[model samples]
Target: MDENTAFPGASDESKAEYILSNVAEVVERILTFVPTKSLLKMTCVCKLWRNCARRVLRVQQNMTWVSASGPSNCDGHALCPKLADEVENIYILPKTVLVMVDSETFNGQDCCYKQKKARKSHHGPDSIEELNGLFPKGCDIMGVATPGIVLTPTGSHSGAPKEFQEGEAGYAIMFPRMEGVDIRPFHFCKNTISEANLVEAGLVNNTDLRVVLLFGYDAFKPGAARFLNQVLEPLARSKVLIAGGHVENVFSPKRKCCDRGSYGVVGLTLSGPKIQGASVLLEQDVSSAKAAEAIIQRLKAANLPERNTLGFMFACVGRGHNYYNNQRNVEADTFRKVFPNIPLFGFFGNGEIGCDRIVKEDYNLCDMDSDGLQHGYTTVMTLVHLG
Candidate 1:
């Protein structure tokens, strides 16, 4: 058979379209085997091909993960079946799980949660067990219940990569893990490095990223500058990607009361080889529009690769649509203006740790502003370059 025997006189584009159409529709399993990059490229081949290829991607993604929000008290336990139903294959279990709940959602007992449904009662430990059931094996679980609006990822949150691009990423933490009490995350901000807590947070010399959550007040204490510097300096020297934030209203003297005591850090140290990335903590004492514009400028300057990227944005709740004249998702909107294809997820917090480093040469950009890692007004955006 000659190259295009069945469509001998067909134009090359027509032949290509025909082949893609048949593959995308008829041999759908083959489409599943296709790389996401290639599938995305196929979408641009033409409208008909685009629809066919995209349907397959959508179907596959729908089978693999779920996104839920708006009021019901859905913890990891309630999450497993929805997860099993959505995902075709299980992504790897995380080395750890980070839980963020509004102070209301977390009952005083054992971090277990009551119902988000109209009528319900449930045990916190049992809920944890149900969540652990979602994992293939026993893995460390930690959490924070905040007095401010609590934020959490709706679907899969594969742990952050450990090591990236032949080196470790940046890192930091606020409080130490609570002693003896299993599964309770720290809620303080001693951000410095002491021998005991390093073991608690699991920091090693060779790692890619670590996320630390601090109580808002501890972020303001006297030694915060020194502690955060000690925590970030070595990682910066090794050229790692670091990002963090403080729990809002959790420790403010006038803030709503929370079950956990007033100090400590909940740190998740991510160290693995499958992903590499950068962080740009953009800040300025200016209008919301101007501040977002400044972030956009710095992102452009970073010049990240335009493919296989996901963004994690930790913005101060202080600056949102209201801050942008009641416009919604302004930070997300501006970030998309820079990398429209990248999916972004994160929280609005009391304060954050931000940096701007695209490559090894950009290491100096990893440090927070002169005031230090915990600041009330900066947008910390990180680009996870999928490996």
Candidate 2:
């Protein structure tokens, strides 16, 4: 049909614009009806439609849950063909692909992102060549990246910190999609961390940093210990929900999940209007049963305003099934009882970068004056509330 018949008094270009604008208008109305968690996964469609509507069709929502699948054997696709297929880029949103296998299987090099088969994305950049101008100035990235809706128009720089070298056995391909919707990255290198560095990284001396995801690598316990003394000691009074592990080399006869990276120490500071967090630290000096009792008491006594949507537990490798007298998921199972049905994920390592501060419901007051220290032989848990 001619443009004159459909859109009278409009030129060809104008008619095209009118049709696109109407399409965007319909999508905008649909967005308001979508659940908050699902709404976050829905992007602006593309840069073209994004510009056409500009502000009208933009949607704002928080990420409550992220689908995590696999232990897939990518080499053969024989072990987990279904899991391998799960990660196929059907959603169009970027996903953080974490692959941890032995050096024999995956050489800790280029194969980390081998599974992310590039197919034509209808709404995203048509080609890798077109990703040039989307990221703003000073937002340079070291490795490859895809521009996706990471809760902002700005770029979520993908790659390891410059300090990390030849990290092997395991690698994490952090696509734009992460557990965090609103977040910032920070690094601590060569045992050098101060107020200045913290400020520059948006870790400390800022109102924005509320929750943090940290990873510390050391054979001994000094790295995590020093972090707590130097970093958390100063901000001992400040309420920061810290969650992460002090990564140690684990050699198990029955290997579960493994990651090997020379990643010294890294963190992601989380903050946004939609993010609310709570945390707890449980010591394991006593018997497993007693420790579980303590965790129950502390968590139950504490009050939280919003329901916990997700959880992260950074626990000691020593405190698992063997420690719990052949009982699997004792710690995790304990957590589930308190905040039932809340999605939780974490790892077992030598040390943890974690703590908890339960606030009063009406007063919104912190209950304990405990310093959030992460050392070996303790369990640190962080529960997330997404508004």
Candidate 3:
């Protein structure tokens, strides 16, 4: 039978249905190449398009950083509802950490009080009360620390610990619920192995230049080389500090309490060799431009896609405008020079978290390898190839 004759009696509604079915298939293919923000907007086009976009656009992982003036005045809580409106679920970094927003300085106690109030208001009554009940008396709420000089989102100051000021407060949200990607957390204890053994363990391979290291108070005090030597030893020539610092991992339920013993290094690891990392220690002589160059070289070596790649930057609060001679956003600006049009989001963390390498075995929450590490005075960058 002729093609036209086959559907000659089809009603207008039937023809429209046929056209939409074909269009839906085409849209599914197109959605694969659409960036996340664009895909979210596409959901508003129509219900059919929304369903297709939702099915096609899978966000395997999402990390968002938000900042506002002081803790009491900050709107960091708004990030939750905003993200919930877009994605199915989210996991926030348990602490509502504070960063120095402006040049004014204040005391740590005052900053802590304001931060506590911020968390109470942001997390709501029940979650905060539950967290409080977990700790014994005299311990501060979850993620609340004595305010100190920390990295700011503005990127204009060097990460210097000035007296606490009437600055901004912010926190990070990490969501790994996307499809087609496996997100897991791993932890590596300090001095657990020799340099040779770490390499043998596949934790410090030659291609593994980007690893997040979170040192406890004892470990962080020894200086940068001490911590760098633990994983980046022998291959000390490669750039690795994309995100890390002195922050402790209090959120992990595996730990009994939020104390120094719980303060080891943890990180998320990817499955392939395409990823590379570079770090700049503000305390060292390295410049932000130089650090960005190291990452550029690594990306070139990997032959990463020029587009559709995403970047997450975790910088020390001390490395902003203060470090770059009052210059504005030098750290992020330098990174953009290489991955110019890619999507990037991160915050100036008291400590930054980034992954190193993937684990081979399956794991549950209680038995997972590591959650990631926290470090101070460093910038950790993670790059993912989406195409």
Candidate 4:
């Protein structure tokens, strides 16, 4: 065929360019839907495909990262201005005392002298309001004190006061707007109680399960008995025995006695859309790979979005290295293997706050307290898809 006939009014180079452009466009579109792990693999296909994949991964605009800094001498007051300007709400995971002072009081210019006593309740409105007042007007706040360290943009801190030790105490804020995606809280039981038994115990109804909180201490004989009764009664009533599975026990050296049971453990179950129901993976005597596989299976079963752009992992402090055979970050690595390229941030917490399921009976109650159930010895993953 003649040159014009073969090329259709285009040179050989131009024809090749036109075909490659179309291929790149198609590849970019496909990459958007592909999991981050697979997308990374696709980068080896060609330079054009690699470039397209990188561009798509980098331009994720659904999540915003905002941060600010203050003098090292400042306490929690230093965080107020920076937080007020950027964060609408705050979740405090404090390892030490976290005091919130009014901006004017902090500046020392005007002492309105509102010496309010710091509330002793956890996750209470009075405490939340005090934290909010530290910031400018119109800023809302909520937080839970964690026994473990807090991770911020600058660096991880124990949240201890500088007077006690030399370290910067401040806040790191990440704003994940809950406009489109479904945010479901999950709790996984380490026990091997059968689903049938769980149903009989009134813990689970068909697929729905209730979150149970267990409190115990070694010093209190009756308290331990009561705790055991609380757990065993349901099983006893149903005549079900925990045949096999890991039972998680969190021990605190700081806890010497139990006036009313100093130790506590919370249980949660999956709830929400049928497809979005929580996945309760039993991790007792299971390898990290196995646990991760189970989690991936549940995610796939729930039909989670193929493109999970952002993730927040609330893992128990005892889990990461200890549970994963001394391998550091095996849990996170396992999650990355399943949902690659997603931006994940979270700290190992002594107790995690996430919902076990959606509260339908008390719709208003759910709205009022959306904070999920508190959990221990579990890793809760809150994945977000901005499709």
Best by lDDT: 1
Estimate TM-scores for all models. Answer: 0.56, 0.58, 0.49, 0.36
Pairing residues by index, what is the TM-score of model 2? 0.58
- lDDT against the true structure, each candidate: 0.46, 0.44, 0.40, 0.37
* Candidate 3 Cα misplacement greater than 4 A, ranges: 1-4, 16-76, 88-182, 188-243, 248-261, 277-283, 286-304, 349-387
**Rank ordering of all candidates by TM-score, starting from the highest:** 2, 1, 3, 4
lDDT of 2 by residue, 1-387 (tens): 865777878788987666655676665665555532344444455654444332322323223212222233343211123323333322223222222222222211221121122232221121111222222233321121111101100112111111101111222222233333455555554445778887777776765456666665443434545454555554455556667665432111111122333224555666654456667777766347657766755655654433435456666766666577876666666666665645455556656666556422232434332244556677777666644
Better of 1 and 3 by TM-score: 1
lDDT of 1 by residue, 230-288 (tens): 55555455455666676532211111222233333444444334345677766745446
Model 2 misplaced stretches (Cα beyond 4 Å): 1-23, 27-48, 51-60, 64-71, 76-181, 219-228, 249-263, 285-294, 300-302, 305-308, 359-372
Residue 23, candidate 1: alpha-carbon lDDT:
53
Show model 1 residue runs off by greater than 4 Å: 1-65, 73-127, 140-193, 196-204, 207-230, 236-238, 248-262, 272-274, 284-286, 306-308, 360-371
lDDT tens readout by residue for model 4, 75-175: 43344456544434322211112122222112221111111232321222332333445433322222222222222232222121111011222333332
TM-score of 4: 0.36
Better of 3 and 4 by lDDT: 3
Q: Between candidates 2 and 3, name the one with more favorable lDDT.
A: 2
